[model samples]
Target chain A: MSAALEALQQRLGYRFQQASLLARALTHRSHGADHNERLEFLGDAVLNLTISRLLYDRFSGSDEGDLTRVRAHLVREESLHRVALALRLPEVLKLSEGEARGGGAQRPSILADATEALLGAVYLDGGDAAAHALVKQLFGELIDTTTIDNWRKDAKTELQELLQGKRLPVPSYRIVATHGQAHAQTFDVEAAVPALQLSSMGSGRSRRAAEQEAARQLLDKLRAPPAR
Target chain B: MSAALEALQQRLGYRFQQASLLARALTHRSHGADHNERLEFLGDAVLNLTISRLLYDRFSGSDEGDLTRVRAHLVREESLHRVALALRLPEVLKLSEGEARGGGAQRPSILADATEALLGAVYLDGGDAAAHALVKQLFGELIDTTTIDNWRKDAKTELQELLQGKRLPVPSYRIVATHGQAHAQTFDVEAAVPALQLSSMGSGRSRRAAEQEAARQLLDKLRAPPAR
Candidate 1:
């Protein structure tokens, strides 16, 4: 095995019985016919299950909705991308020349996919125990440092609670504009708190999502220190 | 244990070490403080992983996309509802009197959720081996009986292929209408095969999804036998 791969295994804290699985996991589809998409697909599920198990045990009192939200926050591309960067996946991923030129190695989606592929490979090579342990090693720290309250409430709810705590009137949301055809439309919403002269705009695939985005933006503005 | 519970165990082909877990899995939110939603959440992930693994093994030659489509079909609400019926979930699910009167037990979403909760309960009760074995017993026959061809191709591709097979002109898809605001738009698409004087309309969250639905409807119409 190459020194890089040997180092990767050491970092992963799990050795692959079949090194080829690890190699495939690090391969991008742009490289050749044999790639990591399948592994990524399988790995996504493995990661989800492992995370669900972790959250289930950690927040024993949390309801299913809160668990789902927290899990989503943890497994989203951004989180996985951070994990990939920590693991230095860019150094190991094999991408085609064009993809490399395009900075595919540093791309969040590619890195995240590779991370999942690696997890899948670990699962296939070392079974459930190894995969579970690997996931814990990769993500347990993030979950540990963050409080469940960070993700338990939706942005709108959190915004409302924050405003209520500060003796501020609730924000009002209005649909600013609609786009697309009858069946596939997007909502652009404006959230305004006239009392504080704060307003923000957000767009999403659903009215609720858009409202939440707007509320989130407003909350961020409220939380930020006043301009110097 | 109640006779009904005993019968359920016989059907599931696995016995829960903790009866409370099984009871919780069978209990809906409306039933009281204890419910199955948490178990359902965990079970959903377990089911996805199990199904993915199954497809990965069964269709070694299939690509990730094909594997995903097949897994989606197998684990969709409709599929789970069918499995729940086989397990007689409606006869055993614990729901409030109002929910019972409202037919909660037979509702597809409720039944499906219960099925997943049951799997989750099994996982918690007996570990991965028991959970995997239970899933195989519940869904193995469905997977074995169905061919990958049934779901490998998207509806649009399948429709196009069918038309081409008969030397018919390819279908044209046009956006009929769009609804909602800038963020959460839905698209209504009309798919037409002028050669066959057939057309269909379908709607979805995206144009591609709408077009596929339209194509699926057209395909169904074409596949129907000619009237006498």
Candidate 2:
């Protein structure tokens, strides 16, 4: 094995009995037909399950919705890319000449995929314990460091969570209008809770964003005193 | 413990070291603030990982996309609900007086979440081996029985995969029109592959169905000889 690969394994803290698995893990589909796609698939599930387990254990006071959101944030492509960069994945990734020239190694999706493939490789080589340990080592600090308040919750999440805490039925949102040019359209959304007779509207560049804005306003109304 | 609980333990093939864990897993959020939501959150991950590892090892010849599709089919709400029913989940579930009167025990989401909570309880009480064994025992028949041909792939999936196999660009779909009453509108969708200079339109009662039909027609077009 090359010294670089050995160093990569050292960083992972999980040495592979079969070095070929590590090599395959770093290979991109752009490189050849035989590449990391299968490993990436396996690794994606492993990474999600491992992270979900971690979040579930650490946040006893948090509900399932909170746990779900936190897990989604932790395992999303951006976070995986961060972990890949931390492990210097871009240095050893194998790519086709075309992709290499196009900067595929630096791409977020590829880096994140390779990260999952690495986990899958470890699991295949050393079983769950080794893979679990690697996941913990790579992600432990992030898990410990992430405060729920550290990130912005989308307005829909904020609205639903506020209602859930109060054991009230969740508010609903609907797209009320779409306007402007086809290229520069805007979405107008209305969020309402029928039981509370509360409603609000907001508009934005996308349907989802508009819904969030509307939800944010509706949440504020929920917080305010009732009007005569 | 009640005789019914003991019967459940017997069926599970693993007695909980902490009986209270089992009891908590059986409790619904409607029952009280302290409920199975947290355990259900943890168990959902454990179940997904266990099933993923199983599928990964068993299906060596299958591609990642195929593996993903199969896993999704196995883990969807209907599948989980079936598993829960087979385990006699309804007999032992605890709900609030209101929910109980409304037959909440038979609800798919409740049953599925409770099933997951039981997994969490087992994992917590006896650790990974116990959990793995439980999952394997519960799902062994399902793992053995399911074949790729048993479930129908959606038109969009079939089209995308056909293109993927041929190294062609994926098609894009857009809603072209909506007609009829608001209560029962028909959607017209167009699927296009600009790279292939091909396009098709289909109409259906729903947007998704219309898109699928359009994709089906596009696939048919791709299969036909050159029109020029």
Candidate 3:
């Protein structure tokens, strides 16, 4: 076994009888036939559930919305990817030569997927409790509300309520156009509500992003209270 | 505040400044205007995150998929509803007179929603940490793996893989007939792959269930070991 792999096992407090699962977990699709896609799928669900339960326990009197926001923050792709990197996951990751050369190890999506796949491998090898322990130990500190609450609110929810509080009709969004090919499409969205005509346009790789941008624009506009 | 509410607060190991939120959390939308829809939404997210984190910590070697299954078992609507009832959540629930007479307080959906809403109210009152503590206290015992392992696997997934493993064509499902009104439907379905055909009928509020029933029948057929 490679020294890096051995060190990783030590840090994670686990030793794999079948190291192949670990290898598969760390192998991204870009690495070729033996990839971590299935593991990633399983890990994603596991991560969400584990973190969710922790937050639920820690925040005794919290509302579901707040808990949702905190969970999102704790399990965000960026955060998971960061954890993966901290474990020196990149050093052990078996990627295609081209991908390794292209800095695939540093990619957020790849790192996040690999982390989840690693969790999957753990579960498969040792069972649910093992996976839960691994994830909790890594994320327990992050669950601190002081850090999570700092960035919980989303623009769309706030903007929607801002209008609704004023007895304004709920905003409606329309996809005006799409630019680019299927895998890389940029959407143009227009958000409108009859009571106030605020025309804002947003562009993103997906419709959701475009809508979020449009909402952000509306928020900026609405934040400026009308002049008397 | 009602004495039932006070007893519940003591059991939860927390006091509510705004007892109204707790009352609202226990009130289902089916009951009246002062229901727990918003709180339920918030609580659902919180529950997911907290559980996810805990599983992650407890199971260092486990992956996301196993963790997800475990969490799903822990937080399924039925499970949450049971927990809500165990906490005596229904006693203080404010319901429309008609719903109260109808025993709406004991309904599973209502109980589940109320549990989520209660989590939401707690989060709102005391923030994420507070909500986490409450959920953890209520559900800490659920983390036992032996209990989680006993959960039935989704029959659909099992049947899908069974066909795939044998290198047969992907199984296809067809709804042969439907009987009953729009509110509650009964369906007869057939699930077939090249070498095997299974048919079964089921009644549910939706079509997915009918298909699941058909898949379940197929599972039964495939249960017997094949000649080596």
lDDT of 3: 0.75
lDDT of 1 by residue, A61-170 (tens): 98787899999999999999999999899999998887888898999999999999999999999999999999999999988987887776778888888889999888
Model 2 Cα lDDT, one tens digit per residue, B76-104: 88878998998898999988877888889
TM-score of chain A of each: 0.69, 0.70, 0.68
The deviation in Å at residue A165 for candidate 1 is: 26
lDDT of 1 by residue, B1-228 (tens): 899999999999998789999999999888876889899999999999998898898888877877888998999999999999999989999888878888988899999999999999999999888988988888999889878877868889888889889998889999989999979999999999998889999999999889989997997788553332
lDDT for each residue of candidate 3 in B15-134, tens digit (9 for 90 to 100): 887878887887765565566765676677667666765766676555344666777888899889888878887787766776777887788887788887788788778766787788
- Candidate 2 colliding pairs: none
Please list the residue runs of candidate 1 whose C-alpha ends up more than 4 Å from where it truly belongs after superposition.
Answer: A154-228, B154-228
Clashes of 2: 0
* TM-score winner between candidates 2 and 3: 2
The backbone clash count of each candidate, in order, is 28, 0, 88
Q: Using alpha carbons, what is the TM-score of model 1? A: 0.71
Worst 10 residues of 3 chain B by lDDT: B144-153
List candidate 3 stretches off by more than 4 Å: A145-148, A152-228, B1-228
Q: Higher-lDDT candidate among 1 and 2?
A: 1
Order by TM-score, highest first: 2, 1, 3
Candidate 2 lDDT tens digits, A1-228: 998898998888777899889999999877765689899988887788788778877887777876888888899999999999999999999988878888999999999999999999888898777888989999999999987654557778888988888888988888989999999999999999987788999999999889888987987677442231
Better of 1 and 3 by lDDT: 1
